[model samples]
Target chain A: MLNSMLEFVPRIPIAEGTEWVTEWLKEKFSVLFDPIKEHLGNFMEFMSEDVLMLIPPIIFIIAVALIAFFISGKKLGLAAFSIVGLWLIYNQGYWDHLMNTVTLVIIASLLSVIIGVPFGILMAKSKIAEAIITPILDFMQTMPAFVYLIPAVAFFGIGMVPGVFASLIFATPPTVRFTNLGIRQVSKELVEASDAFGSTGAQKLFKVQLPMAKATIMAGINQTVMLSLSMVVIASMIGAPGLGREVLSSLQRSNVGTGFVAGVGIVILAIIIDRFTQNMNKKKA
Target chain B: MPVIEAKNLSKVFGKNPKHALKLLDKGLSKEAILKEAGNTVGVNRASFSVEAGEIFVIMGLSGSGKSTLVRLINRLIEPTEGSILIDGEDLARMDKKSLRRVRREKMSMVFQKFALFPLRTILENAEFGLEVQNAPKEERRKKAEKALEMVGLAGYIHQKPGQLSGGMQQRVGLARALANDPEVLLMDEAFSALDPLIRKEMQDELIDLQSSMRKTIIFITHDLDEALRLGDRIALMKDGSIVQIGTPEEILVNPANDYVERFVEDVDRSKVLTAQHIMKRPETVNIEKHGPRVALERMREEGLSSMYVVDSKRNLKGYITADDASAARKNEIGNLEEILKNDIPRVDKETSMHEIFNIIHDSPIPVAVIEDGKLLGIIVRGSVIAALAGDAEVNIENA
Candidate 1:
């Protein structure tokens, strides 16, 4: 599996078009473009609303802080010192731009959960849903990060919308994969106990089964956040601003120091997000 | 009349018909269910009714239908065929709403793994069923507290299942079931996962609880000792079918088949039997010799039951009660006390149960063993037979 994955990893970036090999394979499987376009359209409309763009990210930042506090208490304040340190080193003010990335990432993640969880449940319930979905998940996951930008740019043009859009597709598969896995892995005995004790289908899903699968689902969320953060730098090459744009501009002008600094900023952001989400999962568990 | 009845209950998996025309079909046969499952025959055509308040046990080995059978009683898994009637209402025929209502209102089940909802505190786990049924929050909370109290987990209500010991987790499961206050409690080998000592403690606790609550219980187990300890009538199962359904005494004495007889023969009857089995028969002699006068008087006083007679050594030889001794003289009376022989149950303290059983079976009277008999114990024929059976507890009445 590892050998195949590594060998396939380089194959994904080979848009060095196959002039000889099978045109039939390309045309037969080319239904993804239109749906991807419609999704990009819906995403742009959703993000255009001020409340949709503004309030949720702010709430998410607060929720992240609250989660941090609950786990390590006033220790979270000490971590904020590094945040200030990054701002000083970047030289340019990053508060608004960082907030935009946070906002867009949060919105994408929320949508992933909303869409992914139901898809997961449907997939879990039916073999046909699983059969259709599992291959799509493989394609989404194995397809190159850079390849996502090509279509995202073609469809949504360039903005925070496309950045969030690419991140959603990349990040969503984890949540959906893990949700189905988690729900399916729950002990049959527990499900029977719930049913035997007279839990309605809706009640069983929400109360008994969902809660039991929570730890695994939370793990999926952690994976999603990490995957979304990974897309942030790549998405910056298109036009989504934040640390990514700084890295791009720094590299373009050959300001190696500034680019390195921006790279450090993204790495630090990933670590912080990763740690906080993991800690939040621990607290919930 | 029986409170619960299963009419030819059967279950089959796969969409394939028994005799399939299409090659795509998975064959429907025991071998097919086995090869596909490789190790399960959840339930078969099992039919039995538990009288209200009866401790009905369905006993089987793993992969036997005990779990699936009880689940069928409550319709947890919809039976592939047949119907389940609870108090004259068909559970299998009920609509979803009525089925759920029956579950919430009539029956609650406990699981082998505890399944106590680790995400919730003990109180919340107990209250989950009530909450699902849409009970008032305060009422449910109060009821959960009461249940916790009943299970002796009162102080631990706020603790999660992860924090509790296995025994305590099972208590929480029990508390959760009891909180709903249903008429029937289905125990799916509830104590099977616990340590032996904990299992014993839980079994004793269940007996104590059932004594007070009198819930019509359908308990499943593979252990004959457990079946004997807990059940009023045990249904011995092999594969998916019930081999025998009887009190422990009946099952022990007269197992319907060799499989059941073999199952009972290996069980330790000592754990099940008590002094009640070999008690001295009822006494009919007066305080003195020549005590009774007429045949009618002897019949009225003795009721034909035997009385025990002992020598100076306290050794029992044989017994002749007023009924037999009175036959010696219809017109005249005899020394009723002296005339009666001591035929109380006799055996060495170390007498093997098989020997004792054989002796009792052949004799019309209970055998009396003598060796400085200080009246240590007597084995009643009924109880000996009971002890060898599946779920009969001995009841001893001391003189």
Candidate 2:
């Protein structure tokens, strides 16, 4: 009797409904989506090809190593690691792919911070906003990275722009969550002191909250950059170019040696980026 | 007019504050209202006015709402009901722009935890208030420098707050408020976070600053001794309500209720009770009008061992013991000044009992209370002990 009752319930058409909604959004918002795709795609390509590719590999590697040296307080470890790592990637003939991945990750992380901070501030300032945004963030974070590619392709067609869109959906939550947590974790007495001195909302935010929350926000941004880097291999499924494409093609041909080299290149990039950003945070302190 | 006036000011925390306020007006107790309405009363129908250039202290134990009461004055915590007035201007009714202007121009606050921005240098922390007001950069920098110098932190201007000790950090906090040059200051347990020695040093500095600056101040503390030491007048709070508002002496001598009485019970009375509160009228002989024979006779009649000698205008000359006066009379010394002993201790009327204890311990005769060379009263050992024992009424007749 219970089985019959369970079978009597009709299945919900969530998949069909989502498809219809996506198609409707594509048809209706093409004007808005088209310009963003064209402009952003051109900017990303210009950054990776025109700007980054213009630098000689040796010069770029030395510059990054020097920056690592200074930012890590004259430490030899990070600078040595950067030089060795970049040299290995260059020797492996994945330097251009490395640059493409760098451009994709940097743009995605910047965009996440720009959009996430204000939303985080809103969540911190208002209970209603926090309540409304929290569940949406959870949904975005838990949803599989592959699930976003469909919408990303629908919105931006393909390439680095769609890659960024998918990565942004995957990576933006940490920044928003951390910014909110950082602002909320500021001592109550400090907030009261700010208010007591007649600080306007903007004044309190910029002067007191943001400066105090810096390390935490930087940590969040570091996580975001890592998340964006992780999205590259997945993003290549939609024709986004980079080491991710190298890895994808190697996977298809079952070329374990090439795929392993490409994977090592990504690991080297992640460590370099992570160490540089972490060292920057420590330098400020 | 008062510099800051709060009338029927109240703060209720939680949802349905309107209902809580209605319950407050119906005379329901704080606990009852909390139980029935799920609202906590922060400050309950508080009404007080702080005079210009005086330190008006609000004192209570933790959670008694003294902090809340002070916050209401500056509208840091918006009142659930009632109004606040600054120089006869209704602050509660002011728009946001005007309120911000008033906050910038009229008052600033200091906090207990030394809320200096750790990332900013000491000079930049001091510049915060003026920076918020959008003052010119050069002007704000100059004022911040001057304010930092005022707090004796000129040497540490370029150092961040994290590099300084607790007391020095608090000095930066103080400089931050002073840079604005506001007319009034609200200090919420501003020295509570410091160790006892540093707290005392800060208190003395605040008193010194008050003497020169004479800015109206609203100070909050959970310490009874601090309240007595710094307050020109103190309001004692209990359970979100002010139970008494009076001078420290009044609060100590005649507490408004059992709660206030218990609150002040452990205060060191010697620090608060002064010579004026414990002094007795001294029987004196006028040297120009009376001889040693008359002085000896007057001493005998009053049953005193010694008598203070004064001139026709009542300036303290010295004192004559009964033996000295009698011996002088036998030796034909007509002037009382000829035999008078000049070794008696003298203290001002405002001298604390703590100081009198040190002086009176070495003196054979009573310590004479003098003002401008004229004797007002004398503090005897018995009187000092009596005052410390809470019998301040013993010398009220002389006052």
Candidate 3:
């Protein structure tokens, strides 16, 4: 009798619900989503495919070294490390993959900052906006990166475009949250002093508030860049090409040596980027 | 005309301010209004006028609405139900653009915390007001440099505000305001955050500055001595309402109520009351017309051993004591000038009573109160003692 009763019991219809919701969103917002998808697709291809290939590998390496030298206060050590790291990646025949990964991370981080900062400023300025955005940011931050990949692929089809969209969603929360916090944390007395001087609203925001909040906003940008880097290997599952793809292939073949080497290369790239961005922040301060 | 005047200024810090204002109109107390409408009355129907070139001080302890009242004058805090007039233009009726123009061109403020931008250099901070006015860069720099020199901060222009001491930062703040060359200055406890020694030095510097600039200034503070020293006229506030408005001498000698009396109870009156306040119309003999016999007769009639000898224009010639007059009488001197002693101590009419202590101690007779080489009055030792001892009946004739 227990077996018979269990056989008749139906499973929850979560899959159908998800599909229906997905189709409903697509139907309702295709005009918005289609243009964004197409523009992002074109921009990603141009950055990763055209720009990386247009510059010679050695010149790119030297340029990176030069940037590192300036950002790190003319430090020979940082410039040497950046040069040696890029050379090692080249020697390992992973230069193209490295550039691809870089392009993806850079594009995603830039888009996150562009969209997130203004929203964050809105949140800081208005209580209603903050209330609405806070929980959405919490969900974006806490959700597993793999869980969103399915939806990303569903929305934009399988490509680097979907990977970038996924990375953008995952990396955006910090910039928004920190920007809001940074503006809010400005000294009340300073704000009052600015207002007392008859500063227009725009002047106060740009001259006083933004300059004061630079360190925090830089911190947010750093987080966004790092989060985009972390999304790379996960993004490889959906035909996004890079060192992440190489690592994924090595993992699939159970080739631990190749996977470890690629992992080390990603680390080297991250260290170089992180040091450069942090030095840039210090210089600004 | 007054530079700034507020008529029945009131500010309630909550919604439903109209209800609180109605209660206030019905003469409800601050607390009663708060209890009735949950509206905190920041300032209550405060009416006062600040004359141009006069240092009008608003003084109160914490939570007494003195700061609020000052901000109301500038429209930084809008009044709930009153009008503020600047040069006969109602601030409440002005549009935002006109208000901004007034803030830029007419008045500037100095903050208690010396609100210099920490990230900006001293020069930049000093030029802040000029920059707000959209002045050209060259003119802004020139004016800022001049103002900084006026404040004795000429060499620290390149340094950031955080690198300077608190007193220096406040000087920069002062320069920032003065750079605008505004018609009025609103200093809200501008020196209250400094060390005691630095605060005293800043006060002396401000007095010096005021002597030359003579800008209409409204100073706010909680200290009685600062108010008395700096204020041309003082408005004492309590519980959001002005308790009294009077000159320093009036406030000290004739406190409006128990609260004001208590506020001034611990004040050092000798330092506050000048020689002009306690001076009397002294007995005198004209040097050109009087002989030793005449001087002696005048001294005897006045029941005094000494008489000041003055010219026809009341120019202080000298003095004649009883011994000198007797010597002159014996010698048959026709003019009192031959026997008059010019060694008597003299003080300006505005010299404080505290300074008179030393003069009166050294002099055998009363100190002569002189102004512009003419004798105004005499500050006797009894009057100094009376002022020091807090004698209420001490004659006070403010110069």
Candidate 4:
């Protein structure tokens, strides 16, 4: 009886629908999307391949260590840890791969924040926008990150750009969600008070709303960075090269030791970025 | 003309305000109107005027719409019906731009929560109103500094609002409004959040500020004591409608209805009622109009040990006792000034009964109520004691 009941449930055509949508978008909007793809590709290459590689390895290590130290309020311990961590990745011969992953995460996270914050503010201001965007955010967050790669590759075609495109979708929801939540959480009294003082709409937004929502927006940025890093290994499957590629190849060849070392390198990089951003948020507050 | 006036004002907080108005016109209660129309009446057909430099208080309990009324004066919440006129300019008819100008230049508001910007320093918060007006940076800083000094917050100019105590933060709120140099101020329960002692201190500070600044103010409060202390004339509200409008003594002595009577039932009449409310017409012998013989006869008829002496113009000169009057009459003295005693205790009509007690206790005669050297009335110790004891006969007669 259970088998017959199960058989009665029709399979929905979700994958076919997704394929058609991607194809239709690519066919109709290629002119618009191609430039964006080209620019992002160039920018990613410049950051990961050109500038990072051109700089002497010792100088690069010192710069990263300095950034970590300054942003974390001169925490010598964290700076030393970052220096040691980066040195180990270099010693283990994964320095270039680490740089590639760092560039991808930076680009993806920056794009996410730039796009997500305004949408989040829109959702905060307008009920219709909130109603429409909320379910989209939920789908983006809950849907398997791996599922996004199919359409990313379908449109952009196998490369670092597609990897970034895939990771962008996986990472944007936090900034959008948190920016909306932060603005919404602002006390009604403060908003009314601002209005009562005859603050223009723009003044109120820049002076009151944005400043009050800083910590939360920073929190969103932090989450976006973390989520972007998490997508590195998945993105490598679409030909994006990074520590993720190292891990993927190790998996394919069943080499546990190489994968573990690469994974540790990613974790160290994440901790360094995370602590810097969190400290920036605290300083702002 | 009144600086601010609201005529037939009403505010209903829902979609079906038309239905709410209909129900209200039929003389239904706020609850009934709300029930029938799915609209909550925030303020109902409220009509009052605040004169220039006067503190007009709108007082009620939490749900009685006192806050809503104050907001309506500034058009913070647009009224559902009627019109508001500030200096005879219809606020209800002004465009948004003009309204913004009015808020910037003509009127300012202080909130109950001490709505200082959390991120801005005390000086910056004070500069907010001036900045909104596009005041130049130098001018804004100067004006904000002056205002902060006025509010006794000059020492903490660079400190954020969160660093201050609740009382100090509220002072910053006041400084923000004052910096604008607005003609009228709208305070919506501005001190209701403070501790009791701080609230009293703020009230006294506001009174002192009002005397010096003389700015027209519309103040809202839920506490009867605060209303009595701060308001020059108060309009008591209940269920979104004003039940009575009177001076504090009038409200105490002659409550408009049962509700108002009960509202005042718990009030200490000695604290609120003034000598003017209990004073009676003084039995006087005019020095220019009567001789010492006449003064003696008048004192005898009134059964008084002494009587006030006023000039022909009713200017209070002094008092003369019956013994002095009799001595003057026997000695054939014509000038009554010789027998007049200038030490008779005199008080202003505005002096509260609490202060009158001390003056009346040591006085040999009734305390004469004088304003600007003109005798208005005399406050006898018995009548004051009677008023304070809440004697119905005394209150009724005074009313």
Candidate 5:
């Protein structure tokens, strides 16, 4: 009887409904989406080809190593790791792909921060906003990275822009969540103290909340960068260029050696980015 | 006019504050209102006025609404009903911009937990109030430095609050408030987080600072002893209502209710009671108008061992013992001053019983309570003990 009752309930057409909504949005908002695609695509292209590629790989590697050294308080470990890791990626003939991947991840993470922080602040300030946004954030975080590519392509066509769209959806939640948590976690007495001194809302945010929440926000941004990096291989399916493309082609041909080297390159990049950002947070301490 | 006057100010913590207020007006008790309407009364119809340059303290146990009352004064916690007047300007009715301006110019607060920004240097923390006011950078810096110096933290301006000890951090909190040079200071259990020794030190320093600054202060504490030590007048709260408001001596001497009486029962009375509270009307001899025979006669009539001799203007000259007066009469000394003993201990009328204890222990006679060289009264060992024993009806006229 239970099985018969369960079978009587028809399946919900969630997929069909979602497809209709996506198509309707695409058809109706082409004017808005088109400009964003064109301008954002051009900007990311200029960043990778014109700005980053213009620098000699050796100089870029040395500069990053030096930054790592100073940021890590004259520690030899991170600086040495950066030099060795970049040299290996360079020797493996994936330096251009590395740069392309770097551009995608950096832009995605930066955009996430720009968008996420305000949303986080809004969520922290209002219970209604928090209630509305929390579920959306959860959906973005839990939905498979592949599921976003369809909307990404519909919105931005293909290549690095679409890649950015997909990676942004995947990576933005941490920054928003962390920023909200960080602001909310500030001691009640501190908030009262700020209010008692008659601090304007903006003054309290800048002077007390943001500065106190810096480390937590930094940790969130680090998570965002890592999430963006992880999306690169998936993003390459939409024709986004980078070490992710190399890994994709290698996977298709079953070339284990080539895929392994590309994977190693991504690991090296992740560690370098993670260590640099973590060290920046520690410098304040 | 009072510097800060709160008239029927109340704070109800719940979604339906109007309902809670109605219940409050209906005379529903705090717990009953909370049970019926799910509303907690934070401060219920609290009315008080703080005079300029005086420390007005609000004291209560935890959850008694003293903290909420202090917060309501500055509108950090907005009142659910009634009004607050700052120098006759209605604070509760002011718009946000004007309220912020008042907060910047009129008052600042110190917190129990020393809420210094952990990232900012002590100088930056101290300058926070001025910075909020948009003062010129150099002016803020100078004021912050001077304020820090006043709090004895001038040397630690470059260091962050995390590196400082709790007491020092609280000093920085005090400096931040002082740097604004506000007309009033709101200190909410500011020293409650410190060790007893540091708390005493901070209290002494605050008293020292207050003597010179003379800013109107609204202080909150759960400690009876602290309220007595620091407050010029104290308002005691119980279950979100002010049970009594009076000078520390009046509160100690005549509690308004059983709750207030119980609350102050355990307080160390020696610290609060003074020479004036415990002193007796001194039996005396007019040495300027009367000779040794008169002094001896008065002593015999009073059945006293010694007599405090005062001049026509009531200036304390000295005391003459019965034996000395008799010896003086035998030796033809006409004046009592010739044989008067000048070794008696003299204390000001405001001297605490704590200090009187030390002086009285070594004295053979009663400690003379004098003001400006005139004898007002005398504190005998019996009077001090009687006061400490909570004997409120000690006969000042009998001796």
Candidate 6:
């Protein structure tokens, strides 16, 4: 085997080269990561002072009531009202934290969309592109949250930037996978019909395939949002502050009341955001 | 005389044949081509032509490449070998942009599954072709509305494809095709997926649409009955190759072989074929005031095989078979309507001997094609057998 190696130049082992590569990637990633986090922190901290603001949550609660009235009836409406009442009882003040979380989710989701859609298009169009990207998505999805933090800390150091980056990474697969899946799932008969009508490749993709994929892609968006929310708790370990940080702080100090209260607030936030996004998806469908 | 013609247009699926012009851009090595060869010969050098505004149908079982043939005409599937010329323009020579323009402006298609864009409303779906061609928004919308009205889906403008029944969805598909105002309309089993009743409704709608539009149509189907009912000319296919191409009368009365005969064996003769193929020339008949039933009895009395059903003016009326005349006699035969199996298989004076063979075989009984309710002749199994066996001369008469 060693003599056969002479026929071709010997390649270095991955372990020998990966550490330096990792450090280099880490340095390159942080160059722009820290500043964004600092700016996010400043905005979030300022917003925290006005966290007691209640108008939006109250409105949201009412909207939930209206929607629930139609979906599951008055009983569901009452259930929605009680959920709102519980958020109020927690004394965490719903508005500002919810807004900050919303900002994070929106930013993360938008970034995922930007990266996911083009990547999906490329993957769907070519087998080689799919071979390279699909497995990476599988890894991203399967890897533990703690493992994600290693790259996050090494690359963006610590804070909101790292949180957002982690969130984007975690939430990306659905957007990419679902978009590709929906496009692929469209009937071949329809594609042929469109082609027969003299639709060019671009026209076929955008008008026929993309339009048909709407509901499916929306499902992907919903999945991305849900995944991004899961990153909030893990992101707090990187000093990313908000409900996640509060929950962690209370748990560390053995303050069950504080931990439970903050945890409940986070759950309420998730339900509200999930419900709203789900409704948006329904309307689009 | 053909508006569209394919000279030995063979579409083999394998990567390479000795003389096959490679479909894709880069040429592969013979070894690699051999290794990666795809299976199935989709279109086996199919050669047929359609006259301008003629409803030419291709009928086959699933995977017999009937769908492949229609798609190939528009070059939706690039042929592996041979040439396809549409109005003397070689489709193979057209570039991407030119091909697109041809498709958008010259050709349109109706699909087996309707293929309506569910996201868009009915009106928008119809306007898809115009949109692809960059038709202005308002103009496309107006044209789409008009096309929808033509298909009788006028009130369904705002409805999504999912909101409509299968028949309505197919109508929308037709409307979309018409929206392009295309020169040639390609339909691939457009009504195959609908219910029997709905299929009939759509077929009638299509016949009406085609009559008024006069677009050259290339319709594909597995249903022999549909081909007979709808085609001006039917191209019977098997194993990716055309077995025969002729008028309905020629196909029924003089099928090319046993394969086609089996396919048309159960067909309804009165509904499909005409009364012209089987009509016998009157040999010294002076009685002109007789009904078709009386004419049949006269032929029987004179020991003739068949007799012409002519009017007082000595023009041919529809012919009646001896059996048909006798069948009508079970009840008291009084009038011409009572005695005559008035709806016999009829052919044009111009119908080829080939079509007469298929339709007769397709029908439940031997028949002839009629022109203006006048029989030219009668077709029995023997005439078709002689034609296919290549023995007897085809005594085809023009009306």
- TM-scores for all candidates? 0.79, 0.84, 0.80, 0.83, 0.84, 0.75
Instruction: Report RMSD (Å) for each prediction in the order shown.
Output: 7.3, 7.7, 8.2, 7.7, 7.6, 10.0
Best by DockQ: 5
- Candidate 5 local lDDT, B318-371, one digit each (tens): 998989888889999888767878998999977877677778876888899899
Question: Considering TM-score, which of the candidate structures 2 and 6 is the better prediction for this target?
Answer: 2
Tell me the lDDT of model 5 at A19: 92
- The number of clashing residue pairs in each candidate reads 23, 0, 0, 0, 0, 55
lDDT (10s digit) by residue, model 6, range B212-314: 8899999999887688778888999887778888876677666788877766664433222223433444432223455545656676787755544556555
lDDT of 2 at B385: 51
Per-residue lDDT of A1-285 in model 5, one digit per residue for the tens? 889998896998999999999999999999899998999999989999998988999999999999999999998999999999999999999998999999999999999999999999889899999999999999999999999999999888999999999999999999999999989999998898888888999999999998888889888988998999999778999999999999999999999999999999999999999998888888864
- Ranking the candidates on DockQ from highest down gives 5, 2, 6, 4, 1, 3
Docking class for model 4 is medium
Regions of model 5 farther than 4 Å from truth: A1-12, B269-399
Off by over 4 Å in 3: A1-18, B25-37, B267-399
| lDDT for B71 (candidate 2) | 83
lDDT of 5: 0.90
In candidate 5 the C-alpha lDDT for residue B75 amounts to 90
Taking chain B only, the TM-score of every model is 0.77, 0.73, 0.73, 0.73, 0.74, 0.67
Q: Tell me each candidate's i-RMS in Å.
A: 0.9, 1.0, 1.3, 1.1, 0.8, 1.0
lDDT per residue as tens, model 3, B220-320:
99987788768889999999999999987677667799999778765557657788888889899998888889889988899999989999999999998
Model 4 lDDT per residue over B10-31, tens place: 9999997978898888888887
Q: Candidate 6 on A62-177: residue-level lDDT in tens?
A: 66567655544334744565456545733565345555565666667788988898788787778899899999999999878677787777776776667888888888999999
- Ranked by lDDT, the better of candidates 3 and 5 is 5
Question: By TM-score, how accurate is candidate 4?
Answer: 0.83
Worst 10 residues of 2 chain A by lDDT: A276-285
Q: Identify the superior model by lDDT, candidate 1 or candidate 4.
A: 4
Residue B35 shift from truth in candidate 4, angstroms: 3.3
Error of 3 at A237 (Å): 2.2
lDDT per residue (tens digit) for residues B1-399 in model 1:
788889978655455423221211343545556565443345667899889898999998876778888888998777876799998999999999999999998999999998877788999999988998999999999999999999999999888899999999999999999999998899999999999888878998999999999899999998887887888999998877788999866676577998887777666565434344444443333333334454336556655555454444444434555566556566455655545554355676556556676567666665554446544445557656545533244443331
Better of 3 and 4 by DockQ: 4
